[model samples]
Target: MPKSKFNVGDKVRLNKRAPGYYGHLLQRTRTIISIFYDDEKQGNTYELGARGRGGSLGFFRSYMLSGVSPAQASKIGRPKTKRSYKRR
Candidate 1:
């Protein structure tokens, strides 16, 4: 197992997706309620919670960056489409 970048009680935000229309993905903040890893502890995932009680869990939970900085979030993942050229 490896060290977790964030611990329980840490605050984080989901990386914003321009076409993200889900209400939950509306630039809200979440707290780390729990963290988990695979059986081999090779990969890590997080369980996020709202700021306070009476809150609900997010639909997208797994292998996501927590508390991503504005700069880092911008380029967190690969683009939806890859540019390919025909070899002639």
Candidate 2:
């Protein structure tokens, strides 16, 4: 079995360049609450939880998450919104 990239209680963030529908989790940091091995994928899946929030966010593949420091994880903010202009 493949080893898990991140262990339980570790802080992590979604990789900025991760492909798929992870836009909402782009800049948010979370803690790894659990890890599960996948036989089909031959990899591990992690469950993440945010500070001050109850319950787990969801499961993510190892490649989808990157390790981060506690300080870095604590610094949370929303992405800037893009402005739209009318055509001339």
Candidate 3:
């Protein structure tokens, strides 16, 4: 299997050429928290998270996200994991 374009913990930005519907996300840098592959379509979808925000924004196609520089990733830092409130 080929390697995915973006990996977990990698920072990415929505493609500038993406549709206007994604305009709200254009300026925000998001981190890749998880990836989902669809066998039927043979494509990858990513779950994104923003710094300082808990939980993920949503899933997006690989084509919609672009890789940011490692420097930029460092600046964005990692997304905070959601804590489980339920008792064991």
Candidate 4:
């Protein structure tokens, strides 16, 4: 209904409201992949992501993930990735 605060290339950190929510166990900065709305929760989806040594993190989605915050700029390893997503 309103404009989201984050953009696709922005770096961010996870903000867990409840306890025991592991959000891909990411402690480093994750880039905002995309934003969407889920009718079930009545909130915006903040799809965050990061590059890892093996593959990457934050590829999976979760309803429990509350939101994300700005984080320090860091290396976005591997330059390019084969992964991509589109809104259907």
Candidate 5:
């Protein structure tokens, strides 16, 4: 796959089935705080908003950004088409 064009400050969301550390998953809208590529490490980094547990920081692979921003959330990968989706 090609590298994503997402930049810092862009809003984004996560997929329920998206992989994470320790066999866990997340599915929610979040902000893109940072993006990094580590050729030596052979991977990428994508930091997101804080988690629910006491404002814990959340980080995931760039692939987690498969979902779109809150602004375009309604028109992008929104599993529903019947109801009119609105950004929060």
Candidate 6:
């Protein structure tokens, strides 16, 4: 495979598979969390994420991604979650 040109905030869709995770990937556009390099640090890996639906209070990572662009998704800032009320 050739080197991927995707950036950290790229938006992507997963390539359709036969059965496993074929359609599970969210249709809504998701923000790229970050791109990771292989353990050997030779090439790179892609990490895609999005906010959970229905106020679930969490972000979700995409199992796989395709059909998108690195310039589409905006860069991510710090998380906006508030501190919990429970004490230490």
Residues 1-88, candidate 5: write the lDDT tens digits. 2375677777666664465552433555567667777676667777776643434246667655575735543456647657886999
Each candidate's TM vs. the true structure? Answer: 0.52, 0.68, 0.68, 0.48, 0.50, 0.44
Positional deviation of residue 38's Cα in model 1 after best superposition, in angstroms: 1.9
lDDT of every predicted structure (CA atoms): 0.63, 0.80, 0.81, 0.56, 0.61, 0.52
Give candidate 3's TM-score.
Answer: 0.68
lDDT of 1 by residue, 22-88 (tens): 5565477777787777665466667777667757565333435446544454555788688988989
Q: Model 2 off-target regions past 4 Å?
A: 17-20, 72-88
Q: Which of the two candidates, 5 or 6, achieves a greater TM-score against the reference?
A: 5
Tell me which residue pairs clash in candidate 2: none
**Which candidate comes out best when scored by TM-score?**
3
RMSD of each: 11.9, 11.1, 15.3, 16.6, 10.8, 16.2
- In candidate 5, which residue pairs get closer than 3 Å at backbone N, Cα or C atoms, i.e. clash? none
Runs of candidate 3 with Cα error greater than 4 angstroms are 72-88
Model 6 spans > 4 angstroms off: 1-4, 17-19, 40-42, 52-64, 69-88
- How do the residues 23-56 of candidate 4 rate in per-residue lDDT, one tens digit apiece? 4564556666777776776666666554545333
RMSD of 4: 16.6
Report model 4's TM-score to 2 decimal places: 0.48
Ordered from best to worst lDDT, the candidate numbers read 3, 2, 1, 5, 4, 6
Kindly list the per-residue Cα lDDT of model 2 for residues 1-88, writing each as its tens digit.
5666778899899896576586778688888898999888788989888665898888888878888876544435865675878999
> Considering TM-score, which of the candidate structures 2 and 5 is the better prediction for this target?
2
* Candidate 5 off by > 4 Å: 1-4, 20-25, 51-56, 72-88
lDDT of 3 by residue, 1-88 (tens): 3479888999999886666786677887889998998787788888999675788878888888888886633336555775759878
